[model samples]
Target: MHRTYSLRSTRAPTASQIQNPPPPPSSTKSGRFFGRGGLGHALRRNTAGAFAPDLAKKLSQLVKMEKNVMRSLEMVAKERMDVAQQLSIWGEGCDEDVSDVTDKLGVLIYEIGELEDQYVDRYDQYRITMKSIRNIEASVQPSRDRKQKITDQIAHLKYKEPNSPKIVVLEQELVRAEAESLVAEAQLSNITREKIKAAYSYQFDALREHCEKVAIIAGYGKHLLELIDDTPVTPGETRAAYDGYEASKAIIQDCEDALTNWVSQNAAVSAKLSVRSRQLSQRRRNNIKRRSEQGVGHDLSSQDAPLNDEVSWESTGQQQDEYDDAEEEEDDETEPSKHSMLLNGDGSNGEKRGRSQEAVAA
Candidate 1:
């Protein structure tokens, strides 16, 4: 009877088995037992190789979804400001006794708050999913490496003489490799079938939910703008409302742009700092290694003093920023409230408003 041989089979081959080994076409290349693909894919395709490539592909898609969600949230924030300006116009044109418009404004603010909360929740879920996938892939790498080494050893043994002293050692190794490879394959199978499916489902649902919330936010914004446009008012009041809204939007946009720029710059700075630190660490390690190879003993503690100095400088900068914030807070508490001046029409505060208006005009 002819027996079939599977890759990484634990059975020890008899002399007859070695003379006429059963070889599957898929496992043959260059007249060798291992397949055409590299060692990384020789054992039923690394068991996890099928899903390994998909990890980065899914992460890229998730990142793109996150960017879209951020843009939508920014649009919603701008719309909230527009709605507030419209509510302000409604208050100005009506009699002092009218409170209904303010009530509507409150409802709109509450709805915006809810949308912001939803965005935060979805973003958190995205981060968790990304981290889980990365960790799973990392765990699978060592098993794949061990399997590759064992396969290479097996291939080397195939070329050696049958009566060589290494045959017994090779047989023992084959048994060990078979056991280890089977365990790794089983682990990868479970991960790909269960964990990966759950993570992908969560990300897909989160992206869809985020898009729906953004649509609802857009609808509410369009409705509010239409109400403002249709309100009956004098031409001057109408122009003034639009002018204020545009100016507010411009200021808000400038602030958002500045904040975005600041974040990008800080991120770049942090990355550069991290790279510099790693480079310094590598240099120190290389110096120590070279010294040891030359039979010399150098004081690494003294050599590392410069790295400590850089750490202290970073701490100092953080302390300075905290001090500046404390001083700004004190100044704000000592000064009269700008909002109170705008609302009260105090004669003394009118000069402050005029200066502010001049600054805005400039």
Candidate 2:
């Protein structure tokens, strides 16, 4: 379609043009619309007229389908994430289970170690027990053999002492020897049986190893068990024992040295005390000499009475010969000598002796 408009159409709009004067009706070519011969009606049918509402409906359906597809894709992606997370959780669970198993295995190893120690200790005791049993058996065997020999000897003695009444005593000795032999044989049998039984007793290490094997078969770790079992323990135990022995020896040596030092110190103290006593005595003698000198000085300073009180100082007689007659005058009045014999003085002769006593006291 082509549409041609002429200026002559302004004369009069013809009814024929409205009814049947078009080339092709758009409504007839496609679908129905209101009968139209006007430009406004044709333009309305062309664009916003015919296709507008249907296009809006089709666009709305497309939008809905698109939203559904996006939602489905999103759901699929979410499901994938959930699956991945579940797998991670399962992996973690598996790891936890493995860790738990390993921990149990470790605990089992420690138990086995303890059992091993007990086993070794028990083995040592068993060896001693066996030795004791052997010793007992050996003793019993000898006693039995000796008793048998004695029995044979008494029987022969009876035969040799024919016609002697001592034969009855010899026969009695033979019966006693046979009884002792039987008793010795019984004792030996008992010791041997006990030793055999003790040899078969279960050791702690053997039991522990058995339990470990059982656990290993029950889904525990086998390699770890073997590794733990094969660990080097003997060297460690030997080292510990040696260290203990060395420490004990060192302690004993220290004690001995301490005792020796204590004794030496005591002897030294005694000797020092003796020397100090001698020095004190010497100092005492020196002190006495110094005191005597001080007393002498004091006495000289004071010039007290004479120190010799046992002797008396008499008055001088001045009467000369009578031949000089005038110069010699005799006193008729005479007082008797009042100073008689003197008593013994104290250690010192004067008041200085009292000072000496005070010094000694101080």
lDDT tens digits by residue: candidate 1, 1-362: 10111011122443322443422211011122221224412333223222333323344345334433443453454355346435544554454222222323333443354345344445445445554554444344444554567667767766766566676776676566556545545555555455556756655554444444444444444443443434577766622333234333343334223322322112221223488898999999899799889988433222211212244336634644453343123123333432233225552212221111212221
| TM, every model | 0.36, 0.26
lDDT of 2 by residue, 79-147 (tens): 333342333233333333332233323333332332232233334433344434433433333334445
Per-model tally of clashing residue pairs? 0, 0
Runs in model 1 deviating more than 4 A are 1-117, 157-162, 217-226, 229-362
Q: How does candidate 2 score on lDDT?
A: 0.33
* Residue pairs in clash, model 2: none
Clashing pairs in 1: none
User: Candidate 2 — worst ten consecutive residues by lDDT sum?
Assistant: 1-10
Q: How far does residue 348 in candidate 2 sit from its true spot (Å)?
A: 87
What C-alpha lDDT does candidate 1 achieve relative to the native structure? 0.40
How accurate locally, in lDDT, is each candidate? 0.40, 0.33
| C-alpha root-mean-square deviation, each candidate | 29.5, 70.2
